[model samples]
Every structure is written in structure tokens, then in C-alpha cells.
Target: TQLLEQSPQFLSIQEGENLTVYCNSSSVFSSLQWYRQEPGEGPVLLVTVVTGGEVKKLKRLTFQFGDARKDSSLHITAAQPGDTGLYLCAGGGGGATNKLIFGTGTLLAVQP
Candidate 1:
């Protein structure tokens, strides 16, 4: 079983500041995904990266998959209070089940 781990488990920053979160694993995955969740809500998919060394952007946020497909990172620019939430990284999709291995999670608090 693959275990995904995220860095900076908790982050608190003021508005307009930038931050980066990392996800790592020792196993290679066919794909990786990022998600954000709010209190009492399920996580919402933010982006999915299927190729090694691929990078994707969503507004002020950027997501990158590692060249080895075992790591990923999320970067938010000029973070806003609205960006406050729980960030998660999931990896897997190598088999028919397509189950995902989720990371420990990162809780970000962007204060205005």
C-alpha cells in the first residue's frame, strides 16, 4: 500500500502572502490529485495531474507533479481568506479499482 504524506500540516498566513504545500510518497502512482475541503464538507477536487513533470494552474494556484510521479506540490499566490481550507493530495489509479491513497492533509488558514 502506498502512503502519501503532506508537509506543513498546518499553515496560517495573512492575506496576500504566498505559500507552498508538498505531498510525497515512496510509491509511483499513475495519477495524482489535489483537493480542498471546508469545515463539515467533503473535499473538492482542485486539479489532477497524470503525467510526470506536468504542471497545471488554476487562477492564483499552481499544481505540479514530480518527474518521478511520486511527489507533488501546490502553490498559492497572494492567498486570500477565501483560500482557507484543508488541502489534500491523493495518489493511485494503477489498477482497475482506481482507489486513491490520500495524504495526511494540510490545514491552511488565510487571515484577512
Candidate 2:
């Protein structure tokens, strides 16, 4: 089993604004991943951070992993209405099962 913590449990922003979400943990894992989830259906994997201090960007989204591999962050540039949803961070054991320990998560609401 694994555990994670997220900050600013809730965020509300206007379209074209910028925001950031963070995930932190005391435990280390082989890999860390970010997902954007809407209601009903399963979460969609946004990106994965394996090495410490790794940084990746997807369009207006930027993801960063902590140097110690114990934390991660997601930054959104010029947020849009479609960006409204639940953002989650999950950790992997680097094993064969692809098992995940999910973070409590942060909720983002972008109002147009």
C-alpha cells in the first residue's frame, strides 16, 4: 500500500488564468504519474515522472518531479474551461503489476 498528499484541495480560476497543483509524500517510489480525471469515467494519464528532478510539458501543462523523488507538481498555463476536473498523482512500485497508490487529489474549476 502507498499514500500521498495533495495541497490546495480546491482551486477556482478564470479562463486564461494560471494555476498549480502539488503532490507530496515521505515515501519514495520507482515512478510517479499524473492523471486528469472527470466524473464517471476513469482518469486519463497525463504524464509520468520517473527520475528525480524530471520535468515534462504537455501543451499548456507542465509537470515536475522533486529532486528527492518524494514530491511532484503540475502547472497549467492560461487555463481553459476544459481544464476543470480532478487532478491526481499516483505512485508506482516499478513492479510488473503496475499497481498504484493514488494521492488524495486536487479539484480544479475553471470558470469561463
Top candidate, metric TM-score? 1
- Model 2 misplaced regions, further than 4 Å: 95-97
The local distance difference test score of each candidate is 0.97, 0.93
lDDT of 1 by residue, 1-112 (tens): 7899999999999999999999999999999999999999999999999999999999999999999999999999999999999999999759799888899999999999
Residue 30 in model 2: lDDT: 87
Q: What pairs collide in candidate 2? A: none
Q: Determine which window of 10 residues in candidate 2 has minimal summed lDDT.
A: 1-10
TM-score of each: 0.98, 0.94
What does candidate 1 score in Cα RMSD to the true structure? 0.6
* Residue range 17-103, candidate 2, lDDT tens digits: 999899999988889999999999799999999999999999999999999889999999999999999999999867788899999
